[model samples]
Target: MLPALSEKELDRLEDLLITYGNDYSVLNLAELNGFFTALASSPNRVNPEQWLPAVAGGKVPKFKKPAHEEAYTALMLRYASQVAEELADDPEHFEPLFEQSEGEEGPTIILEEWCFGYMRGTQVAEWSELPPEQDRLLKAISLHGLEDNFELLDSMSFDEHQACVPLVVEAAQGLYQYQKQHRH
Candidate 1:
């Protein structure tokens, strides 16, 4: 189990998963949800494999390529852990606005809508106002989509982070369309 993560961190991780899963039909829904749930319960290390079925709960979607699924899951968890590590310095002041929708279809809708809002907020708000990791994630999400853009080991900057708002927004919209067309 992992400790609770901020809303921004979770959103960023979701954006990355969505982008990486762009090539696959089912998206990294289970992985993302499981990661968050695990984090909420305990901040211990998260193993993507162990977490997958728990997150998917047997309804896991099959991707066109097995490698894609593995890759997406790995990247999503890796980045999420990275976010948690960076923010660990601030424990008392982190929680972001969260609204978990209900039912089997709830996660899909929540993910799509939240990503959309995150991107929009990044744009309307000042760069300095956004978190450093968020800005980088947004920029990466904007240019290459979060999937292709985020380099797990790379360092991020505040400026690059702030500039990612539009990119994140664009990526979120793309994801929304994908989800809409592939209703669960």
Candidate 2:
């Protein structure tokens, strides 16, 4: 099994992603986590080559050095592998790496970026229509992830948004289990 990313390596990876510049739609760390989680839990295996380009928007970034490119790819692969192993070993304990910020009430868990990443994963995986129950699970994620849901989310109270966190987590775990059970 690949070792989990250390804090230092995560910081380095984040820096590398930023270097890709605004021209590309590179995902931030939180979004990458969500993206990898979705792919890892997918019912069908998605080749790394197929999904790697999606990491940097739609095209692979040109690295300054071959070593840099290799390192960047390694970091991403290890991180993705770690996410998969965590879910496979203990789905009940798997957690999305949502960002948190201090709020008037308490720490506010930011779900938008992560949810967006997960949605992207589904798209890249070309997920087909699922059963109603499974679709409901995905909806829990899209509620916060998709841009169209922003207005609805804006209308919700802080507490209401907070309440959705568990639902999203439950949705992720449920999806993983569903894929495991239904894998072709």
TM-score, candidate 1, is 0.32
The digit string of per-residue lDDT tens for model 1 on 8-28 reads 755654554555443322234
Badly placed stretches (over 4 Å) of model 1 are: 1-46, 97-184
Among these predictions, the greatest lDDT belongs to 2
| Model 2 Cα lDDT, one tens digit per residue, 111-153 | 9878888998888888888899999999999998898998999
Clashing pairs in 2: none
lDDT against the true structure, per candidate, is: 0.40, 0.87
What is the lDDT, from 0 to 100, of the residue 51 in candidate 2? 85
TM-score of each: 0.32, 0.95
